[model samples]
Target: MANKYKCINEFVVDSYDENEQVEENDFFIVEVGSIWELQDESYLSDVRLMDNEGRWLEIAQSHLVEDFVKLN
Candidate 1:
């Protein structure tokens, strides 16, 4: 089964700004209390989190231990 987690601290997620048409890093914050699911366990992996509107967002593995707590 996939492990579930809850965001305990706000963290930044790097994303691309399609409108800007640049390769530079664009960031956004994942608020505390957001729930996430472990997606890939490999190094530099990702986690999936659902937004308020029911859309899923992918978060980098770097924030896993730093900002989230395992739920199950």
Candidate 2:
């Protein structure tokens, strides 16, 4: 069983390279109303989520504050 979430706020994330380094000029925005599924929650600061595209992303827990609502 997986928990789903709906985005309530738009947020931007930097693109990372194969080495996991942030690309200075590359970023993407997660628009409001996007839905994501919880992938992993073992990390203390961030949780992994799978977007509609099936891409897994790890975002800061703080960013989720007031930004998403869980849908069980």
Candidate 3:
């Protein structure tokens, strides 16, 4: 079973290139899941978000702070 969530805040995410470099054109808003993988370090760990497309993203804890929530 997967968790569910929604975007409470708007932020931009950048993608990486073949050389592991950040691409400016890859910048996008996080329309991913509100449901996330729980972390032991809530404030110091990166949260995992599963998008509507079944893609998973590991974002910094700061990025998701007060921006995402876990569904029952």
Which 10-residue span in candidate 1 carries the lowest summed lDDT?
14-23
lDDT of 2 by residue, 1-72 (tens): 678999898988766665656779998888889999987563333777778785555677876666889987
User: How many pairs of residues collide in each model?
Assistant: 0, 0, 4
Which ranges in model 1 have alpha carbons more than 4 Å from their true place?
16-25, 41-62
User: Ranking under lDDT, best-scoring first?
Assistant: 2, 1, 3
Candidate 2 local distance difference test against the native = 0.75
Report how far residue 50 has shifted in candidate 2, in Å.
1.6
Instruction: Tell how far residue 10 is off in model 1, in angstroms.
Output: 0.4
> Which lDDT tens digits does candidate 1 get at residues 1-72?
767778898877654343423236656677788876655533224655555544345556676678888886
Candidate 2 global TM-score: 0.73
Q: Candidate 2: lDDT of 29?
A: 83
Question: How many clashes does the backbone of model 3 have?
Answer: 4
Q: Please say which candidate is ahead in lDDT: 1 or 3.
A: 1
Error of 3 at 12 (Å): 0.8
Global lDDT for candidate 1?
A: 0.62
Ranking by TM-score: 2, 1, 3
